[model samples]
Structures are given as structure tokens and as C-alpha cells.
Target: MREGAVRWLSPAGFFTMRWWEWGPEDGAPVVCVHGLTRSGRDFDALARHLAGAGRRVICPDLPGRGASDWLPDPMLYQPAVYIAALSHLLARLDGPVDWVGTSLGGICGMGIAAMAGHPIRRMVLNDVGAFVPKKAMARIRDYLGTEPVFRDIPALEAHLRAVHAPFGALSDAEWRHLAETSARPAEGGIALHYDPAIAAPIRAAEAQALDMQGLWEKVRIPVLLIRGAESDLLLPETAAAMAAEPHVTLAEVAGAGHAPALMDAAQIALVAEFLAQ
Candidate 1:
């Protein structure tokens, strides 16, 4: 594993934002963003593949997830704050970069890239688009409310399998790998790696009127939008509309839903080709 740097940025006055870098320090940089309720660790396989192709992959544990500290309020977990955090992250990089974002991460990338003078040179959005369907968002709420615990790693691993079966046909070893990285030892025993409060902002969205469709039209950067064939969040109509843009690139992965892990070679190759362009 290559060494990574930890940097803090101040967003919303009192919050200290944090992100980490991985892969070769001197190589071309690509920023990897994780989905909501997930962390930078989600990009491990993709990062390793990209690093092998001679690029520096920077993955951030979005606020309230992974090793990053939580904010005082969960409402701040929205994409706008994430866009600001990423803008700061890009500024620290000192140059334009390619981006690979999954779900919430992709939304943040889209939001920032839509603005003027954005630093993104290329983007790959995994399993998300400007329009997220009500059904998909509803399903998210079902799992997001749970605060489950387990007596041991095996039990936790079993739970992860049940909850994340949508991840497609990952091997037992693969499931074990994710389970190990995504669980933490707690006073009660083992639990998921993220803060429970992280779900608050996500659930609150049900009551708000989000205007994500308006935002997608403004993004001018070259984008590669990959959707899971079985995704409920990014409907086909929304994906088609998103791809209708002049600089958009789109792909659909089979046997996956909500998000594709970018775990396979074909997904990595598509992303690498875009970055190399």
C-alpha cells in the first residue's frame, strides 16, 4: 500500500473536512468519490487498478463516513457541501484532474463540474444520474434506518451479505474483504463503519424538493456515466437524458443495482480509457 496524506478543510465555518490520497505520488491524479453511507475505502480495487496504469488516485471519505470526523449537523451532508469539500480537495491538488464517483460521490462531481472554471478534466459517474427515482430512494430509507449490531465478525459478515447482495456475484473472499474493512469493533460488539447520524440528512430528503434535474444540464465536462442494469435510483429515462448531453459517455453494468463496485476489469478499463483520453 502506498502512503497517503490527510488534509483538513474548513467548510460551513466550524467543520474540519478531511480526505486521503493513495497510489503513486508523482503520477497523474484521479479523484475517487464514494457513495452515501460509504467511504473512500470503497475504491480500493479501482484505485489499485488505476495505480497500476500509472495514475495517482485520491479517494475521500465523505464527511460523516469512514475515518473522517462527523459534522455538528447531519443536514450538512448534502451534495452541495460535498462539492465544496471536493473543490477544496482539487485546489490542494494544484491542477485539473479526472474523477470517478459512485452514487452520492458522482452527484457531487456533477454539481462541481457544472459550475464555471471547474477543475475536472474528465468524469466517470458510477450508478447515479441527475434524477434519482422515488422507489430507489425509498428502498434506501429501508436500510438506512437500521442500526444493527453483531456478536462477531462472521455475524457481521453474514449481515453485510444479506444487505448488500445487490452488489452482484462477488466471491466469498470478496464479501469477507468488504466485511472486514466496513465493520468496526464497538462497545456492544461489531457494527458498520459509519456514523448512525449519517442517515439523518438522507432520510430528511424525503420532505425536501430537490432540483437535481436542473443542475445536470449545466455540466460541460466530458462525463462517463455507468449505471447498474438493475438500478432503481437512476431510471432509464433519466440516464438517456443525461447521456443526451454533448460530452456525455454512458455504460450499463449487468447484474448490479443502485451501484456497481467498479470491481471488474471491464469497468476499470472503461474508466482508465476515459482518463487517458
Candidate 2:
């Protein structure tokens, strides 16, 4: 594991955002983003894989997750605040970057990369896209809106496995690692590392059926849409449509549901090839 400063950007003055870096300090940079309820650590395997190919990886703990400071108000956890934080990180990079985003992180990356003359040069959207199914969004709301506290690490691990069943089969070791990365000390024992209230904006967005067509159409960089074969979040039709874009490509991870872990050699190889292109 690598370490760095958990810098803060005041997107909301009351809270501070944190991000971690991996690979060489001066290596080719790749910015990675995690899913809803996940932190920067979610990209560990993918980052290591990319770093092995001589790429520096930066993974930010979006406002309310991982080591990042939690917001006093949940309303500010939306993409607007996230985009502001990412802009600060991009400024720090001082050059164009490649991006790998998973789920919610993918959506945020899509928005950033679509901006005019943005620094993003290439992107990989892992189990996410321009259109997410309404059923999946509703399912996510049901899970996120319910605040569940665990009594111990084992309990937390069990819960994480259950909640992330959509990720398909993973070993006990991987599950434990995920649990550890996703946990923080709570009053009695341990709870999720992410701020529970981060759910507010997600629920609100679902209620309004917020459309992101403008951003999707504006994407100028090479885009890779990675879908989980069984994913309810990113539909097959949407992936097909997205791949029709001149600069976009698509791949599917079999047996997964809402998302793919990208831990296997095949998935990593595909990503490496895409980045190399």
C-alpha cells in the first residue's frame, strides 16, 4: 500500500475532501473514482494493475467516504460538489489525465471529461453509463436511505458482502479486504466508512429522474464502457448505444450484477489495452 497527504478542498466550507495516490509520484497519471458508498480504496486492484504498466493512479475519497471529512449537510454531497473537488485535484496534476471510474464515480468522471477542453484524455466507465435503469436506481435508494449500523468487523463484513452481492463471486479474503477498507470506528464498534447521509442526493436525483444527456453527448475523449453482464445498473442496450459513439468502446464482465470488481487478469488486461491504444 502507498500513502500521501489527505488534502482537503472546500467544496462545502464546512467539510473537507480527501484523496490518495498510488504508483510513482511522477509516473503517467490516471485518476480513479469509486462507487456510491465506496471510497478511493476501491480502486486498489485496478490501480496496482495500471501502476504495473507504469501509470500513476490517483483515487479520491469523494466527500463523504473513506478518510474524507463528512459534510454537515447531506444536500451538498451531489456531483456539483464532487466536480468542484475534482477540479482542484486536476489543477494539482497540472496536465491531462486518464480516468477509471466505477458506478457513481464513473458518472462524475463522465461529467468532468465532457467539459470543454477538459484534462481527461481517456476514460473507463465501470458498470455505469449515460442511462441507469429506474429499477436499479430505486434499489440503490432503498439500500442507501436505510442507515444500518454494525456491532463488529465480522458483522460489517457480512453486511458488506450482502449489500455488494451484485459484484458476484469473490473470495473470503477479498470480501474481508473490502470490509476493512469500507469500515470506520463508530461509537460502540464499527460502521461504514462513508457518511450515511450521502444517500440524500441520490434519492433526490432518482425522484427527479435527472437527465445527463448533455454531458454524455459532449464527451470528446476516448471512452470505454465496461458493463457487468448481469448488471441491473448499466443496461445492455445503453452500453450498445454508448459504444456507437465514434470514440467509445464497450466490454462486458460476465456473471456480475450491478458492478464488476475488475480484479481478474482478463478485465485488467482489457483496461490496459484500452489505455495503451
Candidate 3:
């Protein structure tokens, strides 16, 4: 894989969007987008598998997370801003792209794919839908505003496991990789890579309801919806409603809640198969 950055100007100032590129440059493009508070590295396993199968995979670290530059104003961290950044990234690509997005990333993909002349040829929404439960939204908002300090990598890893237990059963190596990539050296020991202020917009918009039915209906390309069986965020009823659409297909990952970390062979195979179709 190769790492690179794309510079662009936002209302706050100029910033660089970092990304990890894999597979042949001339091959078909597949863009993998991470959830809120996560980075591009989350897709390492999936990207490699797709790359090996002859696809150009691009995983981007959204602004305020991972290697991307933090915004000057926290309010600028909303979905519109993210969509704009994605637009900039896609403009540089050769042709249409197959998209894989998780949680917040999936929301952004819906907006883009609904556009009149979007370049998204296919889409995979990991564990999100138009209507997110109020309880789950509240749970996410409660923790997003705080920045915790850890004594070491091990300590940080423990915290991640506790908060993200819903990600299901990840191996020791997968947990370690997640911890290493999600953190950075801090004054005390280590801290999460993302900007805590990015939570401001989420908190502010908590009261507002999300209605993406119109957008979903507008999408002309094929879509795959992968849901964690025990997820509190994407309810089974919602998934059923989404699947009612002729263009959408649904898959569930057992032993997972809220979201599934696509690290296991089975999980990766599901994505690979969908994208291949």
C-alpha cells in the first residue's frame, strides 16, 4: 500500500486529506470510508484482499481523524463538509468508484450517491441507515466529547475494547493494530488520533431526525447493506425497510452489535463478493 495526501481549501483554511492506496493504479477503483472517530486504517484487511483481487482500493482518513488535518472550527466537521472533501477526492480519480462506508461514512455515501451525476457505481453501507435510534445516538454523543488519557498502548487498547465491545470478537493482533493506529503520543502517555471537537456538530444535531428515504429512493446503482445482527443502531425493521428497495441487498454478521469490524475472513469475503457483483 502507498500513502499520500490531497490538499484542499475549506472555510477554516487549507488542509491535507491523507489516504492509503492499494492495488494497481490502472485497475477499477473502490473507495472505503471509515466511521466517525475511526481512520482509514480500519479498512486495512479489506483493502488488501480487494487489492489482491485486482482492484485499486483507496482508504481516506477523513478530516479531524487519523493523519488528516484538524479543522480550525469544530462546527465544520459535519456531513456536508465530509461530502465536499469526498467530492474533491473523487474528482481526482479516473472514473466511477465502488463505495464501502461505515456508520457516519455510510451517511455521507447516501448523499453523494443520490446526486444527479454522481460517480458512485456501487455502494456498501456497513452498519447504518436513514433512521438511527435515539438511544444509540445518545450513547455515541456521551463519549465523543471527552478525550481520555492512557498510561500506555496496552491501557489504551483496554479502553477501546470496553467502549467498542460491540465490534464483536477481534483477535489480539487485530485489537493491537486498532489501538496502534487509533492513538498518538500525548503529554501523559497516548491519546486518540481524532480531534475531540469533531463531536460538537453531532451533539448539536442530536435533536434533529435524519430522513434519507428520498435519497435512498434516488440512488440508481446497486447497494449492499451489511448489518450487525445485534446492532442497536441499525434496527432489523429499518434494515427490512431498506431491503424493500429492489436495488438493495442485506447481510447480517452474527455476534456483532452496532458495527462489525471487517477483519475476519468471512466478513471480508462478504464485502469482496458484493463488490465483485
Candidate 4:
């Protein structure tokens, strides 16, 4: 794995966005973006799998999460901010790239793919859609801004298993990996890697409704929608509606709830097949 950073200047100031790379430099580029509160490391297993299949996989830690710099103004933590950062990343790449995005990441991909002449040639949206259920939104809001301390790694892992149980039944090793990557050194113990201030704009945005149907209808490229069978965020009906689009392909992961981790071999294979098309 190779680690690098891109220098980007936002309206607030300058910051460095970090990313993990795999596979050959000349291989077709595939960008994987993580969900809110999760870092790019979440895609470690999936990135390695795709890279091994002869694709250059780039996993970026969205600002405020993982090794990326946090924003001074929490208000800058919106989708527009993310879209701007993604544009910079695409500019750094060789050509149009395949995108795999989860939750907030999926929404950002949608915004980019909807643009004319966007660099995204194909996209895989994991557990997200034009219409997100308010119940799921409230559930995400419940923990987005919290700064909780863990006495030990085990404690942190336990908490993560509880909160993210919807990710489905992951192996003990997988749980530990998630816990390790999700934590950062803090006073007395450790805290989540992401900045809690990111929740500020999210909370404010919740006061209004998000209507992305117009944007969704504008995307011209092929899209693969990977939905958790029991997802509260991207409901079954929403997934069905999205599949009605000519360019959309839908896959529902059984046993998963709000989202599928995409760590298993089967899930990775499914994603690889879609991108190959």
C-alpha cells in the first residue's frame, strides 16, 4: 500500500487530503470513498481485492476523517465541500475513473456524476439513494457529533460492534481492524479518528429536506446500486425505483441492515464484475 497527500486550498484555508493507493500506477483508476464518520481505511479489504484484479485503487480519507486535515469551520463540512475536494482528486488522476461510494460518499458521487463532462465514468453507490429515510438520518445524527473515550482497544471495538451492527456479522478480526483504524490517541485513552465538529453542518442540514431526484435523473453514466436488504437509509422501495433507471443496476446484500461492509469475497467480486461491464 502507498500513502500520499494532495495539497488543496479551501475557502477557509489550505489543507492536505490524504489517500491510500494500491496496484499498478498505470492500471485503470478506481476511487473508493467512505461513509460519514468512517475513514478511507474502511475500504482496505475491498481496495486490495480490486487492486489485485489489476486496477489502481485509491481510497481517500475525506477531510475531517482518517489522516486528512480537519476543517476549522464546521460549516465547510457539507457535500459541496466534499464535491470540491473530489474535483481536485479527479484532476490529479489520469482519466475518467470508476467510483465506489458509501452513504455520504454516495451522495457526493451522485453530485459529481450528474455534472456534464464529469470524470466519473461508472459509479457504485452503496446503501444510499436520492431519498434517505428520516429515521435513518436521525439514527446517524444520534452519534455523529459525539466525542467518546475508550479505556482500551477492546472497549472501542465492542462499542463499534454495537453501533455498527447493521454492517452485518463481520469476523472478529474484521471487527478489530475496524476498531484499530477508527481510533486515535486521546487523553487517558482513545477517541474516534474523525472530527466531531463535522456534525454541525449535518445537523443544520437536517432542518431541511434533501431533494436529489433531479440530480439522480441527470446522471448519464452507468451506476451500480448496492443496497443492504434491510437498509433503513436506502429503503427497498427506493432501491427498486432507482433500478427503474436505464443506467442503473441494483444488488441487495442479504443479512445486512443500514449498509454492507463490502469486505467479504462475494461482495468484492460483485463490485468487480459491475465495474468490468
Candidate 5:
């Protein structure tokens, strides 16, 4: 549950970003990144598993989420800015590190891991691949559109359950944990932790194509890809396309939708075993 903040520079300006750490600080580094609008706390349950095994696991709250500073310019929420900030964080770490990224985080991992001599040693992409079509973006937008302020935690939890049904079968306690961790005290009540403006760019990119073939091809390290069996974002064709490539292994998570919550033992083990290798 320990946390640290780093001052990173983006084109827009300097911002303070936060990261949570677990396990022995000197152990091999493992960075876990969450999806769009989600914070580093999303990895708490999984972090415990990796940490207990003696890995130095770090989960970063990308700017605008969790305890990090929100970008003044919402347009800067694009991947390039995020990559730049994360690059700064990696530079500070000063060594090779493994990466576990879900959705948007996976895309960021791809961008960095593809570099000539980036610090990333291995990567795990959850429910995302080299290509994300317009259709999937639209669905993501539908959920991202809701940013209501709730009178109580229970109501907020209920709202999250419906919108994030795609996270796949999180238990009652897990849902409550998510709600509590993902909220901020608003003027009237509690609201989702992330800045509402974070969704604007996503909405604006509904028609844009997200193709990372060049980056994916450049990533030479071993990669473990996890996709929800019922994922709409990562289509059967897209998963097949990535699995056929070099340095990539695909694992299907049954009973999940757009993404697997990774809270359950099975899902956590899927990630732990891959990084343990």
C-alpha cells in the first residue's frame, strides 16, 4: 500500500504522477498499469500475489487518475503524452522492468517496449492487442460517458457494477473495493476518482483507427497476452493475428467480457506465472 510520486514533463507542462509499490524494493521490478480512466489501485489484489512471491511490483496511477494530477489540457490525454510521462518514470527506475498492462495500459506498453533499448524486459497485455477498431471504441465510450456524483458509496458501487459489467464477475466485496478505491469526495457527494474530461479524447477518437503493427513488430521480448473469452474489444481475429506473431502467447480467460478483473486467483495466477518465467 506504499505510494510514491514522480515529477514528469509532458509537452503541455510538468505534472506529478503517483505510483504504488509492494514487496521488497530491491527485487526485480514489475510495473502494472490499468485501463482508461482506471487507477493503479486496480492492481492491489494482483500486486499482493506478485509481491508475496518476492517481486518488486509497482502500479502507476497515470495522470488524471487516482492521486495523480489531472492534465489541464484534456486533449493531452492521448497515448503519446502518457508514454512520455511513463518513459520518465522508467528512466528514474534506471533498469529493465517487466510490464503488465490492461487495455490502454497495454497500448502504452506496446509503444514503449517497441523502442530500440527501452527498459521493459517482458510484457503482458490484458484484453488488448495491436489493433483496436472503431466499434470497440464506441462501446468503451458508452461506459466512459457516465460520470455521475453519487449520494453514497452504495449507489456509486451499483453504478460501477452496471457500467463495468465487462470487467467480468467481480465478487460483491471486490465490487465494493472497486467503488471505494475509485471514488473522490465531491462538493455534494462522491464521484468516480478520475477526471471526467478524461473521456473527452476517447469520444473524439471514436472514428480513429488504432493500429500498432509497427510497434508490435519491434517488440522483441517475450509477451503474454490475456484476453477475455467474451471480449468485444479484442476480437477473435485480432487475438489470432497477435498470437500468430513472434514473441507472443495468448491465454483466454473464460466467463469474462471486455476485460478480466484479475482479482480472482485464477486470473492472478495467469499473470503471476507469466511474469515468474
Candidate 6:
């Protein structure tokens, strides 16, 4: 894998967004974005697979996660800032690139893809839809504010295993890999890498329904919506409506809840085939 960085401007100033590049530089580009609180490294397994098939896969670390810099103003950690930063990153890439997003990343992609002059040619939104239930959003907000430190990697892995159980039947090795990538040195022990302050907006915001159906209707490009069979964020009716729309295909994965870890062969294949088409 090759490492690259792009400077993106936000309200607080320009922050460098780091991305891992794979496959031939001239190959068709595919940008894979991770979920809230997840780093770009989460796409490693999927990236390798797409790269092997001669696709140039670019996975970016959203600000406050992975190797990206934390925002000076914690309140600036909302979706607008993320969308602006990613737009800059997209500007530096070849036009009409394919996008694969999970959770928060999916929202960002949907926002951009709905624009009249969007650079994305096709999209894959995994485990997130037009609207997220208040219950699920609340659960994420509650957990996101914590700065839990683990005495060891194993302990950290265990915590992730429980919290991310919805990511579906990940292997023991996969759990270990996630723990290793997500941990950072804390005052006394290792903790999840993202800034706890990133949750400030979520905690401070008024509770309300998140509706994005308007934006979804604006995206005319082909879209593949991957929903976890048991996902709370993307309910059955919403998924069905999204599927009913033009150029949208819904695929539900069994044995997963909030999101499916695209690391597995079956999950990765779903994304690969759609993007290939």
C-alpha cells in the first residue's frame, strides 16, 4: 500500500487528510470511507481485494480518527466539516470516482452525491440509510463521548468485540486487528484513537429525527445500499423505500446488526461487484 495526504480546509483551518492508496495509480479509482469513530485502516482487507482486481482504492482517515489531525474547535466535528474536507480530497482525485461509505461516511457520501456537480459516479452506502432512529443515534452518542482506556490490547479488543458486535461475525484475528489499529497511547494506558471531544456536537445537539430522504432523491447515480439485517439505524421500511427509488439496490447481510465488517470475502464481494458494474 502507498501512503498519501491531501490538505483540506475547514472552518478551523486546513487539516491534512491521510489516505492509503493501493493498485495501479492509473486504474479506475474507488474511494472507501469508514464509519463514525473508525479509521481509514478499517478498509485494509477490502482495499487489498479491490486492488488485486486492478482498481485504485483510496481509503481516507476522516479528521479526528486514525492518523488525521484533531479539530481545534471540537464543535467543528460535525458532518458539514467532514463533507467539506472530503470534497477537497475528492477534488484532488480523478473525476467521477466510485464511493463506498459506512455509517457516518455514508451520510457524507450521500450529501455529496446529491449535489448537481458531484464527482462521485456511483455509491455504496453500508448499514446506513436516509434516516437514523433516535434510539440508535442516542446509543452512538452515549458511547462516543467516553474515553475508555484499556490496560492492554486484549482488554481493548474485548471492549471492541462487545461494542462492535453488530459488525457481525468477525474472526478472532479480525478483532485483534481492529484493536491494534484503533488503540493509541493514553495517559495511563491505551485507548481508542479518536478524540473523545469529537462527540461534543452529538452530546450538545437537540434530540430530533434525522431525515435525508430529500437528499437521497437527488442522487441519480447508481447506488448499492447494504443494510445489516438487524440494523437499528436502517429500518426495514426505509430500506424498502430506498430500494424502490430509481437506480438503488438493497442487499441485507444476515447475522449483522448495525453494520457489516466488509473485511470478509462475501461482504467485500458485494461492494466489488457493484462498483465493477
Clash pairs, model 2 backbone: 231-257
Error of 6 at 73 (Å): 0.4
* Candidate 1 lDDT (Cα, 0 to 1): 0.79
For model 6, the local distance difference test gives 0.91
lDDT of 6 by residue, 1-277 (tens): 9998999999878888888889999998999999988988899999999999999999999999888888999999988899998998888984879999999999999999988888898899998989888888888888878778899999999999999999999999999999999999988899998989999998998656689989888888899999999999999999999999879999999999989999899999989999999
Best prediction by TM-score: 6
Give candidate 2 misplaced runs (Cα > 4 Å). Answer: 5-11, 204-210
- Compute the lDDT of residue 263 as modeled in candidate 5: 93
**lDDT (tens digit, per residue) of candidate 1 on 89-108:** 78788888899989889888
- Which tens-of-lDDT digit does each residue in 1-277 have in candidate 4? 9997888878997888999999999999999999998989999999998888899999999999999999999999988988888788898995889999999899999999988888898999999998886777787777777778999899999999998899988999999999999999999899999999999976776533456888998887899999998888898888899999888999999999878999988999999999988
In model 4, what lDDT does residue 256 have? 95
lDDT of 4 at 257: 82
Which pairs of residues collide in model 1?
A: none
> Each candidate's root-mean-square deviation in Å?
2.0, 1.7, 1.1, 1.1, 1.2, 0.9
Q: Count the backbone clashes (under 3 Å) in each candidate.
A: 0, 1, 1, 0, 0, 0
Model 4, runs deviating above 4 Å: 205-209
Model 6 / residue 52 / CA error / Å = 0.2
Superposing every Cα of model 4 onto the true structure, what RMSD results? 1.1
**Candidate 3 structure quality by residue, lDDT tens digits, 6-93:** 8877887778999999999998999999999999999999999999999999999999999999998999999899988888899889
C-alpha lDDT of residue 23 in model 3: 98
Rank list by lDDT: 6, 3, 4, 5, 2, 1
| TM-score, every prediction | 0.92, 0.94, 0.97, 0.97, 0.97, 0.98
- Please, what are the lDDT tens digits per residue for candidate 2 over residues 81-131? 888777778888899899999988888898888777789989999998888
